[model samples]
Target: MRISAVRTADRFLPERLSRQLNPWLLRLDQMLDGSTEHAVAQRVSLIAFLVRIISAAIALVSQVIFARWMGQFEYGIFVLVWVTVVILGNLSCLGFQTTVIRFVPEYLERQQLDHLRGILFTSKAFALGLTTCIALIGAGGVYFFREAIESYYVVPFLIGFICLPMIALGDTLDGTARSRSWVLVALTPTYIIRPVLTLVVMSIAHAAGFAPTATAAVTSAIIATYTTTLFQLLVVNHRFQAVVVPGTKTIRFGEWFAVSLPIFLVEGFFFLLTNADVLMVGRYMEPDKVATYFATVKLLALVHFVYFSVKAGAAQRYSELMHTHDHAQLSQFARDTARWTFWPSLMMAIVLLLLGKPLLYLFGAQFTDGYPLLFVLVVGVVARASVGPAESLLNMAGKQKICAMVYAVTLIVNICLSIVLIPVYGLAGAACATAFSMVFEAVTLALTVYNRLNITMFVFAGRTNARPVKEEI
Candidate 1:
């Protein structure tokens, strides 16, 4: 009916507008048909892009409110602790969050329901258990070093530890949902619901006369994280039961871990590479400066989300193509993803840079000082975007060890450069360090993909010869 309507409208529409509308309508029709791999990936990428847009708005609003309510110092403290918790929570998954994306599609392709059920259950359990242990260790560490830690950060850091298990669980569920192309289910809990809930909880606490301190913000976060994750657990499990029949589960712990550990190293290094600048700035600079730098990074998320949205949508497709051994399709899709990632990122970076100083001023006037850092940081972001999610491709294709090695080397460069530059040049130094490391990461990953798979992963690369396929899954 919709197609009929579109056809009818196309007959009456002016040629100029119809030229524009026709291509998009045709693409929509292709997506609605859902027969081709390219169409499916495009649809999924569109959904992920929309979700990230909404999430970015919510996060921006929430961060601005927190900055206003707590002032720069307290907000900085809260940002530092919260970043720590999130990083640790994601790390505690030990790569199961991502490994699920690789294995679930392959298992289903082979009609291995037992393995599918096994992974779904095991990933969540492993994440919850590991994160819980990490949380306990974190609490103990805080207790043992309370006196040595800053008086203001101690309690908030302890409170932040309580959020780890839930955060980890949410991440695993996110991957599980993504593996099935449930974009809303995959992204909503952590990205949309959690930030909104945090703001609401914090607002209520403040209205009730609670002090707007780092501790209060962390308390609100704890409540929000638990609420979001438990609800996600119920929804995800219910959806899983509907799709996967009840049966005996097969737990392939050894095989899963063998893949996961290298992926863990890749992710751990990637996370540290991305966030090390902020952490180092926090270490050397005062809270206000930290707050300023954090705000700049948050503003940059508008541009960064393009890469993430593409990665989230593209990973499962990469795994599927690998399973099918369709090298031609895989090569085309990989190049398509790089184009999808780079152009939008370039546009968003330009728009954000135009509005960046004003956006930082929304956090506080002093934040405008960090606006110049945006120019430096965006170079690396665009550089990384030039390769799209080639790393995801590598991981799904059983090249995780090499990918991990690439990220590890990039991270070392980032850390060493940051250590030397941040103390000397402050935020600008950190930005330079991060951007340079990103360039290094992108070049290395592109070369790795080319060398191992004979596929050029860069956006601007021309067409190439297709390689003979010998591997079978």
Candidate 2:
């Protein structure tokens, strides 16, 4: 296919048309065929974007099915519980999930195989152990607080706790795989395989005479989560063997933990900030309302997934560049990532708003009420994409402490606004609070990157005149 394009360009294309098409075609060919680091990163970003697109479709279809099967109230309960669990599971890594991404590249670059082997062994063990303990404690808390909690949510929360350790392990494995730029290995299990498995398991359970309640839904999630995570564990471990043969492992517990703790704060606050709106809505509204808001949020993922795709591909490359102390390349790549993130996200956001009503109706007729909120919510998403993955660049550049501070301030603002706004404005208020918070987060992170790293990361920042950072190497 590339050859055909190249041949046509050489033989038949007019001068102006050929001039316009040739550069892009050449870059596409290189992205497909080149062996350079830049080519590899582009390929990973392209593949990750494609995977996220597929994942979004699968998720949307499955959520619509769940809503149809269980009704708004029960589906709302399930989504609330599931979102909480996912956040906790990712947090349960205590930053090791991301820490691995930072350190693994450093280890491999220095040929510190013993430390590499040690970190690989310890990160999984630590996350699994910590999360298991937390899950147990969570179960105990639920048991003790069952009297005060809503009876409908009680069973599902307990079931969600049971899935926590596996979720944590899966996340850690995902980071390990990503650190190696094994894009498919890193993404497929969590994104493609797990969602599909969850849908299949839920269908099987429903067909087997189980009621389509949140409890039943969560039980299906447990089976799917365990099965998918175990499969990922095996694959990541097997792949690691080719990278580093087993030997005497050197565990740098103090150093690893020190690095990971600040990251824990950054990631924790970031996750909470991302989901706090849904949680706040769940707190102040009925289950049906929660379902409506969640459905709206899910539809907006058409725009949201663009940032995540660019982020997933950019983080490891940023880490590599940071370690190399290549200020010029790092600055340019950061700018490139912002462009990659913003334009597609803007396009998707416009498309999502255009289709918002019909898409909401897919959930249920009542969900169309949330359509007006899309306009409010999309402002934040586009504002955020304008900075691309600025937080990622900061985190990779050893500036996570300040990044955490930025997210912390944003989260506080979100919660306070939600508290003040939700009672008065209801779901519209929640949307307003979230959108404002996202805009605040984006502005702060972009400013922080520029101040700390001397890198102009905004999507619209002029490339030719980008400020140069001091070289650390």
Candidate 3:
């Protein structure tokens, strides 16, 4: 009897240990095993999640190094200039990035290769041309406003504008890759390669005796952006060649612009809403404070990546599912994604907050001052995650105008709150305002999703009675 009991214990112990140790492996196996919508979504989400994990690590390390190299004041200037350039570059895509995702899947579904080819070429060309124009206008504005701007910011800002065309092109390429479900190809160049290249270039410059200033850093970024973007463009074109084949193309500029403009509004508002806090902080505080706040926000990015990863993988899938009229599957998937976003985000938030001070210290001891703001900021990030990527759902479902309206309101609230509070409470006030805006944005988005699609978008929402809705397209 003793021998038999020992055998049973040995058998159960190993099995239990395997189950406990390799749960993610088991989940991964499930994800890759089938061709079902859920399975595909899971696989893409997992890939995107992993990519973000790597990107986050790379970005964190790079930012730390940059902060150390440039010191607080220069780092602050670089960050502010870079952030403004990035935001403008993305906006200059003029919604073509997301518009391509919406249109590509449908074009392929309908076997409209001509339309697909047209969009592939048109989006890049449109983004490049439009961004160039915007860049020129930005340069002119900088020239005219040079006297009014801070002397330190003027040169870097001018240099950063040179990156606009490439940034817009990169964004459009990302959309094309995503629509085709090429997750690695879609994400790797922009997220992984670009930052790595930026660090390498900056290090080389510093070694060559370039002063570790905002101008040097911005120059490195411009070089990195152009290099990464051009390389990405080549690779993407190569892939498209094999899959799409050569054919006569058609351009539907008027129709495409009609759809794209509203999407532009949506994305524009979202970008502004997300970055208004930083900009407002820069407006109200000194470079040292900006450095502290930016460092803290970078730490919080560890949590924010979860939502972005899920959204990146899920957007094309949402478009595909909507086109197929699979209301049931779409609703279920929406709920699943919300769960995917919230739990990981919640866990990350907890971990980041617990370790917040130490992580901020990595940037520098002074940065540790921003640690307390993490608690205030995490609430908003977690709240945004609670609704998952419902905005993507609405945009894919042809509710972009309404989605644009929601974001517009949220941006207004964020800006107003930031302006009102930053003067009073400083960094903490900025955090509070941003968090409140996030909560407001999440609630409005959740209600919009429920009312329009009959899908409960919140993480805690019950099973939805998903009825077939008329396709906006």
Global lDDT of model 2: 0.91
TM-score of 1: 0.96
Q: Which portions of model 3 miss their true places by more than 4 Å?
A: 1-27, 470-473
As for candidate 2, its clashing pairs are none
For model 2 the local lDDT of residue 376 reads: 100
- Which ranges of candidate 2 are over 4 A from the true structure? 1-8, 11-16, 464-473
RMSD of each: 2.0, 2.0, 4.6
Whole-structure CA lDDT of model 3: 0.90
TM-score of 3: 0.94
lDDT of each: 0.90, 0.91, 0.90
* Model 1, position 202: C-alpha lDDT score: 98
lDDT for each residue of candidate 1 in 1-473, tens digit (9 for 90 to 100)? 44543475579988787877877777777876665877888888888888889999999999999999999999999989999999999999999999999898888878899999999889999998999999999999998999998888899998899999999999999999999988889998988999999999999999999999999999999999999999999998899888888999999999999999999999989998889888989889988888999999998899888999999889989988888887888888889899999999999999998999988889888889999999999999999999999899888888888889999999999989989999999999999999999999999999988887778888997776789643313
TM-scores, each model vs. reference = 0.96, 0.96, 0.94
Candidate 3 lDDT, tens digit per residue, 229-341? 99989988999887788898999988888888899999899989888899999999988899999999998888988998898889988998887888998898899899999
